[model samples]
Target: MKKQYIFAVVVICLTLTAFLLTDSSDTIVKYPTGYRNWTHVKTLVLEKGHPLYEAFGGIHHIYANKIALEAYKSNKKFKDGSVIVFDLLEAVNSDNAIAEGSRKVVGVMEKDSKKFKDTGGWGFEGFNGDTKERIVKNMYGECFSCHLSQKNNDYVFSQYRK
Candidate 1:
């Protein structure tokens, strides 16, 4: 009986160790808490006729932290730790008027020159809907590929306007 109990404990430990070792990623982007209060950079609605209306068509709002906002205003390279959030929400059209609907995803671009050097010094992530569930598996392939087109703008698509 004691031998069986010891074996069970060993098995549990090994299982836990394996699980820890097999976690998705240690460098996963953290959910941006209090991002709503950040500086509002812009709002764009990608209607059905828009060029990028398939994958990202929605009521997208951009928010930038202080560091990111400074870069936007200065037109300089984004400093490390500058975080920009893209809040993607459904566009509910009622009575020929459009309203903000449920959230689709909260996309984020966090600048870290050393950490994300391969991805043009930015880390990309997407939080599924309103929850903090991470959806980005391949930051370089899934995200950076599309963003590469905006290489001149520091791999950022949206431009800051007054």
Candidate 2:
């Protein structure tokens, strides 16, 4: 009788474990319909003499990546994540325009551009493109407020501009 009782207890434990793992309430993905367009985008390289030259005067190719995570405003789905790209350029030293150096850093970062303004659109957690886990959730601020310290040149290091 003891053996039978122990067996029954084991069965109950296994069943409970399975039910907990399969629970959908913990990982429910929620988002509004017709909100996928906010996530698709392409990189851009501003050329000289362009209307946006002042903003991207010496900017060259802009490298960026995309990921999906839970949305902050409306959507709470991991189907969307924030995409971040760094703009690399040959910047002129602030003291002298004739001096040149490479500035391979982020000038601007767009998170969930497609779904950025969408209600229920997911927001990004982090973007570390160096590793296979380029995008992950539950990390980094939705917006990088630390860059506010660089407000001298519109939040971008203008020292690199020619």
lDDT of 2 by residue, 33-127 (tens): 23223342333445467895764455443332333212222233223344323434555646644332464333334434344333223232322
Roughly what TM-score does model 2 have, to 2 decimal places?
A: 0.28
lDDT of 1 by residue, 61-109 (tens): 9999999999999888899989999999999999999999999999999
**Model 2 lDDT, residue 137, Cα:** 39
**lDDT, model 1:** 0.90
What is the lDDT for 123 in model 1? 89
Worst 10 residues of 1 by lDDT: 21-30
The segments of candidate 1 whose C-alpha lies over 4 angstroms from its true place after superposition are 1-26
Best by lDDT: 1
